[model samples]
Target: MSADSTHAVEKDDAVFHLPGHPLPALVTLDSTDGSGVDLFMLSLRRPVLLNLFSMPVRDGRVDLPSVAQHECAQQLRSVNAELDALKQQMPELAVLGLSLHAPECLRRVREDLQLRFELLSDQQRAWTDKLELPLQSQDDGSQALRRCTMLLVEGQVSRLDFPLRQPSEVGRRAIELLRRETGTM
Candidate 1:
């Protein structure tokens, strides 16, 4: 490999656990618009808030999301609602939602919940595999992506929160970072 490529690899390794790691540029995630886009490329122009969550399993065993999951989703929606007010101040700020379900599945939830942000379906789990985010253990022992949030600035992950304890706090944190970075506040 060339020296630049070697240095890039070393840098990626160094920030594998850090906050400023560069994300994959070509993750072909399906958006609500039906066309697919590369996540890193989409976030390159500005800051992107990535909210990783999962839908409630509708198998024969359970029909509704657990209390914790429901609360998280509610908080995420709240964050999406708050983003509308910030758009005037930060035009380049964007919010993207991700789930492990297929596009159709996410579409139903998005429409039903009237979500303001776009949702990306990771049906193949390719993105999760690349990031190595853990799957949360269910009461029945199945695994799914727990609530996680990431802030990307210029294609680099500026902050990452996993096993998110307070969803509303995430919105505040992201807004604070954006304000500080953009000097708007």
Candidate 2:
């Protein structure tokens, strides 16, 4: 991370620092549309709400049968709905979903949930590893990223919500942050 990417704020003798690590410039993933997405480049163009999802893996792929019953999937559905509303209000924001699932599986989920944002696949775990995201051990003894949300501005993680407790609150929190940053709130 570059010095310029580091962010901090001071108010009334209190200091708040953002996440220290900026996403690597070379990070890329396969979008559900079958095109390569340069995540760092996208962050440069607009603020990105990057939502990370972890799903059960089976037979070298995300277990499709288990998704419907998975809590993460339920959380994803709520988050996606909230993000859709956020996009309607702020079209400039770039909302993306990232997971270890294959592109085809992500596409199916997108369609099923009527998600408005793009879904990207990190099948090789390269991007997650680079970010050093926390991993959750699955019942099948596989590892998947823990559910989290990141706000990336100009390739730097400005805000992060790890171990997200309320899936429905994510968009509201993001809106509050963006509005405060833009002086619209």
Candidate 3:
């Protein structure tokens, strides 16, 4: 569906609501370049693979450790690299990663992983609160958004995977969904 006047632009202050039922002009933070990315605007140009992770991955798991202290930012980087390669096959596909971390930390992780795609930061939980994604209680008495991924075809939510069972399979899973949706493979 083309982004036109039919789709209402939902907004509350700086928070934009992207309901699972499907909404238009989705908005979220894109701290990857120290600027915000309008997901809807971007998707209007092409399909989007939005991966929402709880926190930065370190040593194969999501850990709250300094980038220098962590030996590796596994899981995500591996999946991202795979997905980046698949971009050649799915020309119109845009892969994006969103995490609930500060931009500073995200930058370090991005540099450490040498990611080709953007890794956005949602430090204020603006998107999370609006999405109302499932949350898990942390040992520190705080709640964290569960890791999940969503496929947005032309700015509309198409498919979602909650509490991603296997982080390693993110690329493959997204590829299969995109191929199935776009009939690319």
Candidate 4:
């Protein structure tokens, strides 16, 4: 393989485990609008807040029962509300949601929740597989992407919250980071 290809493979093999790690530049995700978003580029332009969530998959399709769907929606709403508050304080922040659902599914969720930020599809699991992100067991006993939040500043992870038990904590973590960075805490 070419040197560049080897370097790319090496980068992809490096699992991100903590804050201050650089996000791989080649990471791209499909937004609910069906547009490709290069997260590294977005972070370069402004701070990027990324929330990773997952829905149970059955027979290779998103499978969320009524109660499960309701719970997911509630979690998303809580996260969105926190992000809205954060956005009010920092307009330059680019809030995004990532999930294994298809773009169409994400679009529906976004519309249903009236989310203020974009939700990106990771159906192919490129971001998760490439980054080697942590996985969690679903209600069906299948593995799914673990819910986590990450704050990227200039393409480098500035803060990360893994195994997020409370979705609303996503925004609170970002706010805390901002406060510490600005010495306003």
Number of the predicted model whose lDDT against the real structure is largest = 2
After superposition, the stretches of candidate 3 with alpha carbons farther than 4 Å from their true spots are: 1-20, 23-28, 56-72
User: Number of the top candidate by TM-score?
Assistant: 2
lDDT of 4 by residue, 122-150 (tens): 77887777667777776667667666667
lDDT of 3 by residue, 1-185 (tens): 32321122222222123323453345658667777777767777887777776553444445655543432244466557677565866777788787777777778677777777778776777766666656666555556556556666665666555435666776676666566556665
For each candidate in the order shown, give its overall lDDT on alpha carbons: 0.65, 0.70, 0.61, 0.69
- Indicate the residue-level lDDT of 131 in model 3: 61
Runs of candidate 4 with Cα error greater than 4 angstroms are 1-16, 58-60, 64-70, 139-142
**Which 10-residue span in candidate 3 carries the lowest summed lDDT?**
5-14
State the TM-score for model 4: 0.79
Can you write out model 1's per-residue Cα lDDT over 42-72, one digit (the tens) per residue? 7788778787776556452333335235754
Candidate with the larger lDDT of 1 and 2: 2
lDDT of 3 at 80: 70
Q: State the local distance difference test value for candidate 2.
A: 0.70
TM-scores across all candidates? 0.75, 0.80, 0.73, 0.79
- What is the C-alpha lDDT profile of model 2 across 41-119, one tens digit per residue? 8888988888888776777677778877776677677667577566765678888888887888899888776777788
In candidate 4 the C-alpha lDDT for residue 149 amounts to: 68
